[model samples]
Target chain A: MDVFEAVAEPTRRHLISLLAERERTAGELVDSLPALTQPAVSRHLRILRETGLVEVRPDGQRRIYALKPDGLQRIDDWITPYRRFWRDHLAALEQHLENQ
Target chain B: MDVFEAVAEPTRRHLISLLAERERTAGELVDSLPALTQPAVSRHLRILRETGLVEVRPDGQRRIYALKPDGLQRIDDWITPYRRFWRDHLAALEQHLENQ
Candidate 1:
């Protein structure tokens, strides 16, 4: 799956959210998502790995998962131009709030 | 459909990419994506509209489409925490480049 497909899944997105804070073991990730089973989390991790969003490193008995910033460049590139839209609107909103 | 389902389709993402530059008419968007037929483009636009990603205003004979920044807030909220990953790596990369 591509970056788009990888992020489209809410479960995978939640996993990314967890990793955003710090690297965690596969067991730790499974504990965070109470609704999902270990196999389901494993599948989600596989999809994330295939999409290049997450990297795994062996740490003796456990594999640690970490966020790969380069993997997110596709999204950053896609959203870069569009940021002006928010900046412009936010500036206006700030001015309006200041006036009020 | 929800935001996830709406953005998962590649045609819809392509339509969004076009609108990122500037607003366009239905005909204009159709012309831009030569690979897809007008009906397909219309369908994609419908999905974008339902997801609140794009808004439409009538210009007499034609409807003009524009990007809605609020629609993107969902993504922004989702990505906010993860942005630090890029910022940290980017700062390190910049330092590395400076040293070279």
Candidate 2:
């Protein structure tokens, strides 16, 4: 699964939000969501890691996870064009024409 | 599945990108993707509609689809916080502290 799929799960999105604030230990991540078990959190973390949306580093016994912003550039690039949908109508039309 | 899920599939992302350029009829979308069967494109369009990522309306005999920018706002909002991850180190640290 890519970053888009990795974030499709709400739990992973929550994990991302948590990491956006600061790098969190794996244990802290598990504790943040009381509804999920440690294994469930691990599963989600694994997806994020695999997708490159999050990176992990050894911190002795603990593993630290932080937002890997580069992985998100694809999503950002995809959404950039759609942003014109909300821009001034005249400007949008001009950009549209320029692309043609 | 929400907008994130709607866009998770590459075909759907392609559809969104097509719509981002301009509104397109169902047939146009199907034709743009040569490999996928018409039904497959229809199914993807259905999911896009359900997720509010794409809005559809009948234009005479054709159904036109366009990106529903409002639906993407949630994703844009969620990613806003993470944007700081790429900013200058000092700025990121200051923003982190401000949020605390």
Candidate 3:
């Protein structure tokens, strides 16, 4: 799956948000989401890694995961052009709000 | 599917890029993509509509499609936090370029 599809799920998005703060071991990541089974978290991490949104490295017996900022460039590039539309609308809204 | 999944396909992304410029009828969209069968294009359009990335309205005997800027807010919001990481990196790269 592409990065877009990888991030479509809320669980994966949450994992990304967590990794944004700092790198974490697979165990630490699983622990962070106590509600999910260890396997479930691992599955999400695998998808993220496969999509290049997250990078995994060996840390002795454990695997470390961190957000790969480069992987997100595709998404950022895709959204860049469309930003003008929203930014203009948002700017107008802000102006209207200030007047009110 | 969510907006991310909806836009994962390249064809869907193309349709979005097209609609970003102007509203088009379904037929016009299909005409723009001569390589795809009419049914295939329709399928993509349906997915876009279902995901709320594109909105359709009755235009005489045809339906008009346009990019729904509000629908993209979820994606924009998701990327907002990550922008700092990329922005910082990009700014540093720009400074380095100027120095060189």
Candidate 4:
């Protein structure tokens, strides 16, 4: 599955958000999502891993997972053209921030 | 549906890509996707409209569709943190351009 669909689920998006902060172990990711069963969360992680949006490595008995932001380039590229729609506003905001 | 899922469909994403260039008539959008039936195209447009990612207005006998980029902020905000993962590389490229 493409990264777009992989991150479509709310659970997966939540996982991406978590990994963005820092790398986490399999247990940590599962524990962070209280509403889901470990299996469900594991499935989401697997999809994320398969899509290359995430990378995992064995850390002794634990598996560490982190965001592999390269997969996100597809989304970034898609959004680039649309950014011009609001570029002037964003530029103005940047100007305001520089003056402050 | 949230904008994420709304744009998740490849067809819908294509439509957004087209609209990003400029507002397009309903016929123009439908014509752009040759593989999809007119009804299928209209359905995608309706979902985009209902999700607020796209807005449609009637122009005489035709309907016009345009991207309401504000709806895209959700995707942009979600992507903000992840951009940091590749920011340094992009910044380096920007610096190279500035130097030239």
Query: What TM-score goes with each of the models?
Result: 0.84, 0.83, 0.83, 0.84
Q: What share of the true interface contacts does candidate 4 keep?
A: 0.42
Candidate 2 runs further than 4 Å off: A89-100, B89-100
Model 2: lDDT of residue A50: 93
So what's the TM-score on candidate 4? 0.84
Candidate 3 chain B worst ten-residue window by lDDT: B69-78
lDDT of each: 0.86, 0.85, 0.89, 0.87
Tell me the deviation in Å of residue B21 in model 3.
Answer: 2.2
State the lDDT of candidate 1 residue by residue for A1-100, as single tens digits: 7887888888888888888888999999999999999999999998999899999998999889998997777776766677778788889999999999
lDDT (Cα) of model 3: 0.89
Ordered from best to worst DockQ, the candidate numbers read 1, 3, 4, 2
Tens digits of per-residue lDDT, candidate 2, B1-100, equal 6778887899988998898888999999999999999999999999999988889999999999988867776677777767666655547777999999
Off by over 4 Å in 4: A88-100, B88-100
Native-to-model Cα distance after best TM-score fit, residue B81 in candidate 2, in Å: 1.4
Interface RMSD of each: 1.9, 2.0, 1.7, 1.8
Candidate number with greatest lDDT? 3
Off by over 4 Å in 1: A93-100, B93-100
Best by TM-score: 4
Q: Which 10 consecutive residues of model 3 chain A have the lowest summed lDDT?
A: A68-77
- The per-residue C-alpha lDDT of model 2 at residue B53 equals 88
